[model samples]
Target: MAYVAAAAVLLGLLVVTNLILTVGVVRRLREHTAELAALRGGGSGGLDVDVAMPAGTPVGGFDATSVADLPVSLATLGERPLVGFFSPNCQPCKEKLPSFVEYAATRPQGRDAVLAVTIGTREETAALAELLGPVATVVVESDQGPVQRAFGVSGFPAFVLVEEGVVSASGFDLAPVVDRDAVALPAAG
Candidate 1:
């Protein structure tokens, strides 16, 4: 009977130890998840704080010149310019570019209104420029340059709607830009 009692106590201790270890692991997993979200620019949920500047914020200091030498500026644009930031190394950016190019091609205003800034070498950005150049102006820069900063780009594949020298909407995805001025953006700040 004493042996039986000892065995039961040992089993209980083992169970308790397992429970404690499980809890610790779960807590560590939660911390890691939060850290990843921070690294992914606030996760896939929405635009991160670093890039969620509200609409109507004045945007300036971006050079209007492009490789094409076509003058482009938020203040000087005649229509609502959809600006996209992309990087050659970003998978999502590469995947998202086709849709963005299509959207720019089909914009209702029917002018070359879209603008894309890609960070890469001349060769790396050439294909991207070719895709967007027909319907948009393409600007190549080293690193995230002043134009991207003016537009609040915290990560690759960021986009914003600039109307009259100010940001009207921004998002990690294109849904917000699609719904822009028509509905609420999930990541709008």
Candidate 2:
């Protein structure tokens, strides 16, 4: 009888320990999720504390030649253009490339309405440029290139939806840009 009681006590302790560890893990995961969301520009933080340029910021003037040898500039961007900044060495940029391309493909104006700026050497950026070519106007530039500088982009995989040279939506994730046109109005009461 004593042995049975001791065994029961040990099992209870083990179960309690497991529950505590699980709670700790869940708490830690929540914290990490919040941090990642902030980094991804999903929070209320502005560009000063956020990952990239914020919505409503005006795009500064910039001029650069596309991979096709065509001139690309703020003035050349059609109304409601989508702009994406990527870096060849950034893992997140690579991971986000496919999604960006998919979203760009859905644009009504097609390739002419999207600009993809890749920051790296021509050799390093080749693959990215090719991937983005079919969907956007691919521009290869250095880290301090005019395109990135004009956008005030301090992070890779940054996306912005420009409406007449002004940012209507911008974020580290494409959600803001992709969902901008999805706003719905309420029905009359």
Best by TM-score: 2
The global C-alpha lDDT for each of the candidates, from Candidate 1 onward, is 0.73, 0.82
Per-residue lDDT for 1-189 in model 1, tens only?
999999999999999999999999999999878766654542454324545346778776566577788776675455477788888888777777888887777776544567788887779888887777787778888775777767767677787887666778876677677678334323332
Model 2 C-alpha lDDT per residue in residues 36-91, reported as the tens digit of each score:
66665445443345345677788898989999999998777777778999998887
In candidate 1, list every pair of residues with a backbone clash: none
Write down the TM-score of every candidate.
Answer: 0.70, 0.73
Segments in model 2 whose C-alpha atoms lie over 4 Å from true places = 1-48, 183-189
Best by lDDT: 2
Candidate 1 global Cα RMSD: 6.4
RMSD of each predicted structure: 6.4, 7.6
